[model samples]
Target chain A: MALIGILGGMGPLATVDFMEQIIRLTGAARDQEHLPMLVANLPHTPDRSAAIIDGGADPLPALLEGIDLLNRNGVGVIAVPCNSAHHWYAQMRAHSAAPLLHIGEVCAAAIAPQVTRAAVLATRGALSAGFYQAALVARGIEPVLPDREPQECVSACIAAVKADRPGAAATHLSDVLDALSAQRIDAAVLGCTELPIAARELARPAFALVDSTLELARETVRYALARGWNRPV
Target chain B: MALIGILGGMGPLATVDFMEQIIRLTGAARDQEHLPMLVANLPHTPDRSAAIIDGGADPLPALLEGIDLLNRNGVGVIAVPCNSAHHWYAQMRAHSAAPLLHIGEVCAAAIAPQVTRAAVLATRGALSAGFYQAALVARGIEPVLPDREPQECVSACIAAVKADRPGAAATHLSDVLDALSAQRIDAAVLGCTELPIAARELARPAFALVDSTLELARETVRYALARGWNRPV
Candidate 1:
């Protein structure tokens, strides 16, 4: 399998969560059987949500630096765990030597197979950017976004998880999911990386949950493993 | 703060555990407040335990390659999550411009503050190399290693974790700890990275558990945070 690269540290904990998901999904019995990963946890990058919503410092330079290092080290495929960072995806991919996986595309593809209507649980910046929305629309699936109140709930939830408070975010998350279930939503896309951590605290929700982080990981693994066995012994 | 670097993926999950520990210890409430980390999750490097005890392929070249990448990328301080890999610590540190944190030294230092007699729960390779043992002795502490049967138990526990079976390893790990407690052991250093995951399955053993992965992570965070803030404004 080709070595996988992760441009992470959008929020350090989310990056860790993404890596854990990849490890879990790989189901490798031996360390060597697991897909090799090179994770650039360069978390000091300016906040993507803040940058897009409130004119914060641009995180593009830092993102480029991380991608360049991964490329220089010869990673075969790269994936960024942060959804908000995908606002600069095209630019980052254009500059990268390796292919970068699109979180939205993967999540949409995963969703298209099963549900027609799904709620997008994401950062306000990512919601405003409409990447996941556009991807689902292109696939002819309806993408439901959090309303202003629910968006505030998501923002608070993400902030709590960033501060290492997964439990604190659970109540608000449950309320958001309850609202979605009321709308007869078929599933919810955990479009933001941090949302998945908060989702863990909830007892299986009323609707199916499509985890964007896990989907990206699953896709990354499939993409890498599919790249032909290491040129045979 | 200086950028922190982790030479990880000796076993990918252990590496993630180490990163999570670092994040937890940093107490960062926001993305920027967290230490900037560059993690090289390059698991394709030959197995450290096999390389050591079985006379398998030397992992020195691979270790050095990963270290060199960290140095090249301007990480101010480096730490390795894998205890067994410390067999080549001196050589790896020698090849890099950045300082590599010693898992044993940090672990022993953390242990010295409270305990005098500590158990070293590690792979056969690490015990044979005597890195943890020597560090404890230098700190004027007694290092208790597993006897032949206990060593096999420790190995089995580590294998179970590597194979993603923490529950299956819990019984044997408890037995090993019970034996250590019989000898008046005050603490046990989880010298193998995988052992920490297995240790989690046990409900606080009678003796203290000194996790080498967590110790290394704490040291790394302290190292980077103390490195004189990234050139004041």
Candidate 2:
């Protein structure tokens, strides 16, 4: 079996959250039965939102460095858990040794069987780039994107999660979901990884939630288990 | 600030749990404010207890391989969140480029300020090695060691956490804690990294609970914040 690589830490906490989902979703019965992952948690990568929203420094060099380390270690599958980082998916794959798993494609696939229209909750960069929106459209689903005001709320909710303020994050995130529910959207695509922390308490919401992180994890697991990295020999 | 290295994934969940603590403790106000961590989440590490208890395969080679990878990456501080892995602390440090933060020593420091006697809860490998016990003793604190029965409960709790069964893990861990409290112990040292997950809901407990994972994370935060990794430059 090949090594699994996670080029993560867009925000340190979100990366760990993604890892937890991978562990839970793997359903391993023991320690060794779980996947072998090498995580390049490079939090110093220039902020993806800042880079895209403003004319800030490119995160490409740092992202490539992480990929190089994973590639050097002979990672069979390389996965980037951050949704916003997918803006550079093409460029990242161009310099990679292994195939990169697309979060937007995975989330679109998860949302298709359940919902007709989905709300996109992500960073302004990811929203403007339309990576998730394009993927959803490609799957024959209507993308219910937030307007300017709601996009500001989405940004705040993401920042709150990064600051470890769960209360304010959840409150603001719930408001965004409620507003989208009023639009007759059947699902909300949490296109930003940090947003999932805030939406964690949404038990039976007004609409279904397609967590990009979870879907990406599910895809990673499916890709891995099929390759027989599920357990030791 | 130097890049932080975490050689983790003894049980993948335990490593993620520790990373969450670090992020929360860092008090970062933004994504870039968090620490830059490179985690080698190698879940395929040979069972530490099996090696020490039943003479199974030596985990040192794999342990050294992880350390070498971190060394090559130019990390300033290396931390191993697993208590059982500390059995090879000296040897690992001998091969490591960066100084390894000793989890037992950090836990002993956390326990020394408040308690006279501390209960030791860890894996069979860590228990038999007496790393945490010796650290407490060196700090002029008496170690309230669990008897055979409670140790069995501790083992079961660790196994349950690895198996992703919270109910069984929590119940067995509570039993271990209750037995320690009956012995008039001042505090219980969660000498195992996985034990903290089981004890998460023990609010206002019967005795003081010194979590080894949190203490190690706290020490890591202090070490990091001093070097000005608390926020972006």
Candidate 3:
């Protein structure tokens, strides 16, 4: 099996969520049957939004450092769980020698066929940065956004997740979803990892919701299995 | 604060262990004080030992793939918890744009002042590959090893860890430590992450031990704080 390396900790809960998904998707009968992994959860990273908006610390150096560590350790493939961090994917790809599985790309590919015009409910930074819009556009899907007031609510929802307040985030996100529904958006893409937990709680099946995290996990499972890492016991 | 990216899962437990240490060391209060991270825990890596001993699949490609992911994400520094994987550090470093933190180097640096001659009790692959010896020598420290019989015991201890048999691994490691004591080595380096858990259980105070996992954690905290990622509340 190939050694999987994770560069994580956009939010601690998101990292845990991703790990749980990996384990559940592996379908291991026993603990030993699970594949080996190398993870560097550096939670000390500066805020992604702060880096983008406030012109503070750039996170690219630290992110590259993590890649070096994985490369040095001989990890087979790498994935990052942070949705907003994908904004720098092009630069990171240019500097890296290893193959990186694109979570945003994977998520876009999965949801493209299912939804025609999906509302992207993410952080103001993510929306402003055009991270998801570009990827969705490439897939020929039109991405929608919440109205001005709900956009603030969506930002608050993202902040609530950063504060580890999933319940509060869900409430805020519920409002945003309602606003998106008012706009007649067909589906909502939970563009942030923390947003999914709240989206799951709201349980509004009135409109299809695309969870980037779950999609990333599904793609990761397929990637691992296709490479024979999920050998049968 | 700089972003710290982790490329991990040489073993899942080891990755968890490292993350726990980072949290403990950070002394974080609010969630914001914690580091922001991006993780991709890939467990599809081929066995490091098989690659070294039996000439199995090379992990370099996979390792690079992981590095690229982190680099693209903009991590400032990267760390991996596996000692055996460090054998490929030089090659990985050459391909990496970010600075990779060296667990072995961190361990060697931490133990250098305390001991002149240290006995290494590690996996057969680690011992056979001469990674520890080479690292210690580079740091101007002399590394001692157990005889073939005791070395076999150490290998058994490592196997017990991979099998998740902490008790058996502890017992075997105790025997190896006893053998090392007879040779009058200054201290024993629990060069493997799993071995530290076992060594702590055995708890032979008479033999000073260098735990690479614990040391790496300490270094990570220091690195984070030094870089201003974590601030006192």
- lDDT of all predictions: 0.84, 0.87, 0.73
Candidate 1: tens digits of C-alpha lDDT, residues B171-200 = 779889877777878888888889888888
Best by TM-score: 2
**B55-164 in candidate 2: lDDT tens per residue?**
98889998998999888887889999899999999999999879899999998887747687888888888888988888888887888778999999999999999999
DockQ of each: 0.66, 0.78, 0.14
RMSD (Cα, Å) of candidate 1?
A: 1.9
Candidate 2 chain B: worst-modelled 10 consecutive residues by lDDT:
B201-210
lDDT of 3: 0.73
Clashes of 1: 0
C-alpha RMSD in Å of predicted model 3 compared with the true structure: 9.9
- For model 2 the TM-score comes to 0.97
Interface RMSD of each: 2.3, 1.3, 5.9
Tens-digit lDDT track of model 2 for A1-233 = 67789998888878898899889999998988898888888888888977888978899998998999889887888889899899999999999979999999988888757688888899988887789889988887889889888888899999998889999998888878767767988888899999888888655587888888898889888888889886665
Would you estimate the TM-scores of all the predictions? Answer: 0.95, 0.97, 0.56
Candidate 3 Cα errors over 4 Å, as ranges:
A112-114, A230-233, B1-32, B35-229
- Model 3 chain B weakest 10-residue run by lDDT: B36-45
Tens digits of per-residue lDDT for model 3 on A1-233? Answer: 56666777676667666776676566653324666555666555566666777786788886787677767766677778888777778876776666788877888887847577888877666777887898888888898877789988987887776566768888998888777776666678888887886777876767888888888878777777778765522
| CAPRI verdict (incorrect, acceptable, medium, high) for model 1 | medium
